[model samples]
Target chain A: MKQLTELHAMVSKAVDELTFPAYPTDLYEPISYILSLGGKRLRPALLLMACDLFGGDVEKAIEPALAIEVFHNFTLMHDDIMDKAPLRRGKITVHEKWNANVAILSGDAMMVEANKFMMKVDDAILRRVMDVFNETATGVCEGQQIDMSFEQRNNVLIDEYLDMIRLKTAVLLGGTLKIGAIIGGATSTDAQLLYSFGVNLGIAFQLQDDILDVYGDPEKFGKQVGGDILSNKKTYLLIKALELANGDDANMLDHWLSVEQFNATEKVAAVTGVYDRLDIRNYAEDAMQTYADAAFNALDQIDLSEDRRQYLRQFADNLLVREY
Target chain B: MKQLTELHAMVSKAVDELTFPAYPTDLYEPISYILSLGGKRLRPALLLMACDLFGGDVEKAIEPALAIEVFHNFTLMHDDIMDKAPLRRGKITVHEKWNANVAILSGDAMMVEANKFMMKVDDAILRRVMDVFNETATGVCEGQQIDMSFEQRNNVLIDEYLDMIRLKTAVLLGGTLKIGAIIGGATSTDAQLLYSFGVNLGIAFQLQDDILDVYGDPEKFGKQVGGDILSNKKTYLLIKALELANGDDANMLDHWLSVEQFNATEKVAAVTGVYDRLDIRNYAEDAMQTYADAAFNALDQIDLSEDRRQYLRQFADNLLVREY
Candidate 1:
């Protein structure tokens, strides 16, 4: 089996080689631009890893792996527009660089391109792969809608937030693994087990992100600490704090959330103070570990050699143990 | 073969019966709302008609037909936002009613839904059908992008305009017919012929629309007479006029096009005058007839019985022979 780093490099090289039509510059250019502004390419690498783990032909998996990568970027392009994000991976976003209309149309084109790539699979499993893909894609949209709706309401429950993240972020990871496993010629049961492992790990990763947003080393986090708190974003930490805080702590949290203006450091310091007092970090960490453990348990059940299993475990460990 | 009316009714009924999940009302509601505000369902009806022409089971074609309808509306929803259009079919557009973000997201979900419906095809043909669907979809997006690009440029050629219309408007029609023919057990050669017929007919239909925009009876034409003139839209008549006019006619047409504000009726009349002087209407009619004849010639070459050929020819005639 290929090492994770080797698979990642392969995916990156394939992404670099991708080309789009040159005529409709407004439509195809943004697609090329967004794909060029590379992310970690983690999802596609995991897909290839899953395929290799199952003894499938990794070379044959490259195009479908690229499909997952393209699909991931497509979602990011659209989500950037919906989120009004100006930057992606430290570069200007497609919508900001072009316009919303261009982004929208180009993103639509990317979805078609993703599907075209997906059709490269052997014809026998085409239907099953597409069924999973469509469901995953649909869930992501629904999750985004729910997440947007949460912005207007103050009553978002923790479970609902978990469901939202699972839909928005986790399913794609799970679906990516499942597609790879299918391509790798794994049994349906084993494919679904890999999907479960990916999902739990995904949820844990997002919770890790929530924690890192508030507490990670400024140098390593690559974003402003407590930015979520400054925007009153309904992260798991904030939601849990909202549920558990009361009296003086509640009043302080309310003031911080409601205030129209404050010094950036002051706000972060103040909100982080509230979280510290309530030990919301511990609560978030506990939830993250629970999911992480669940992911390992699913991994344990999969029918791979211990060496390969340890390889996946180490990958998950490295993912969660980001420099902080 | 069932009558066109019967096929159309089947499509409408199928569309009406379509339902989406009720949660995330912001996302799903716009989808249902836009689908409910129906057009003629012409694309899907034609799909069903093509299927029946080849003696395919009409019932088996319903889901894919609905896929075409949903895909068409998905384009309209996004296009309305890009065009900043206020109304569609005399009702408020989805973007206008719900907001651009909602329209964008809902349109995205609808695209997924369209693919889901597309997957209902028989197993043996799913990949082939999807190839056509994705290619058709990608072309439509490219066409819209080119059409939008033209808004900022004055040098859009007649051939480029034709190409844009073909990509944006005609290919979906052609692709729809081809998909239907494939489902109806058509040989690849026959399917290509039907596709050619649809493409030529679609171009002719669009040209007829351009002519009607200037010259049709205001009462019979659903849209405001010469609305395209008020907007300085580069339709065939206007493009041809710009190419053909010189001296006084050139100055007048340029003055009207470049003017920021004017009485809508006067602009329409003056533009119509330019068209009359250039005999642009006849040019448009002759071009339309050339395509119409090409469509008939392709239809004649198809392997279908003469009776079935006449049925399709009659359908195309009625489509072109709208009230005005």
Candidate 2:
């Protein structure tokens, strides 16, 4: 547990130390600027934590962990530019802070640097790391693509959405933990179990995210509460509403989604009303719990000493039950 | 030689046939679109050539070759977005055809797919390939960042510019060839030498490109001749021009770069005038030859059969001497 805390500190320190060469000064400023806008170094931290749980040298893993973080942020920087996202972590995005072109170029460099840093890992684990990285990277892209494609689709089924999140969100969480486990010399089966645990927790986290978006305390929620509701984002609750809607319920849901402009509060209230009628919140919760239970089950299946397993399980439990 | 040609064909066919799963249908459309745009397929094809040159199965090498090609095109898509000069091979840039966001995401996916494809290689070769791939990927990014950094500077030296291009343009070419050689079962020393050959050739290729951008025949060049001239890009000629300019020459060069509204012909004529004053074009020609000679030297130094080396050298020679 103490090691996990120390590993977290190391990830933060590594993030602070990274700098892109400044010769063609314009190209790398965005790299610095984007990284400066902080998010939880969760993926890398998870990797470090997984390493520590198995008594691996945390120092040996930090560079690779940092590589994962840089790679993740690089995607976000470019993704923001692509999504025309105005803010990240409540700050103006890199593209917004700078411009789209700079963000795109710097982001490309960041990804390259990510691979460069991963090269620091020992050769013994290189292929295993790279192979998993390839799949994780591909999965993230697939998830994003699926997430975007939903915008045009009339029928984004619950299962399809689950798969999308699996690709986009869960796979990386799974992969990161699994990478850490593998690096720490976990058996392949143990790595699989760890990965499944992280991935299932990730889904629960996302589903909780959807719930909190509508029902959260605004101050605790950080950003605009009910943003997903207002934006008509195809979150689990909304998607389930679409699936469960009948008679007047269907009509109201369509009207709300189709409404080009409305008061934000009214939109939130209307959507919440529909959710209440169908108890979509419970549906989302049940679905979320199903995955969360799966994650715990996965953790239980791991062959680590029970104490190590419990620590990992406790973290997952905390992650699922968090308010923010 | 015939087998070499078959190797090239087989790698090309595999690259052409390689398809990534479309989880987010829109995410990778840009990749397919750009891959569809078609270039010489030189990088992957070179890998195959190197493989057979080393007496390795072209079949076993094909996926890794495709991986390299996929990587090459990913760089192009992202680079095109950064450079913002439309029309790669006379087609609209990915950002132009789709949005910047899609190009960025798809490009990321392409890079991931490249790694995924490489992971499928025999485990024996897979580790070394990933190491080379990591090195090349980082080198490419470093080169690009340096190139970008150079854009904002006034006193960039010729050697520094050469270094930048070596990172930006040459390393991947070297890397591509080395991967092929490695996969093809070339010895470590030979692979190292092959990498140098490819890198040196890449540097020469870029220098030739700079020359052709200003001087190539319009139709044969397949681009807007003098495009770099108009952009005030920091090419070898421009870097040399900055170093060599004196009296009125320096003033004229500065004025030309600062001018917002010069006719294309006027801009080209003025830039060419500066190039002539310092014999910058001749300096560039000499520099290009230096690199080309180095490439040939590397090729000659390899332990592989001279007859085998001859055809590849001949192909590269045609490139070095081409007017367009």
How well does chain B match by TM-score in each candidate?
0.98, 0.94
- DockQ-based CAPRI category assigned to the predicted complex of candidate 2: medium
What tens digits encode model 2's per-residue C-alpha lDDT throughout B1-324? 445456667766776776755546677677788888878887788888888788887778778888888888998988888888589988999888877667788888888788777777786776688789888887787787678767778999988999999988899999988998998888899899999999999999999888888777888877788899998999999988988899899999999989898898998998898887788878888888999999999889899777888887887888787665
Which is the leading candidate under lDDT? 1
* Top model number, TM-score: 1
Candidate 1 lands at a TM-score of: 0.98
Residue B234 lDDT, candidate 1, scale 0-100: 89
Alpha-carbon interface RMSD of model 2?
2.3
Worst 10-residue lDDT window, candidate 1 chain A: A315-324
Give DockQ: model 2.
Answer: 0.60
- Models 1 onward score TM values of 0.98, 0.91
Residue lDDT tens for model 2, A175-243? 898888878878889888989998999999999999999877778777688899888899999999999
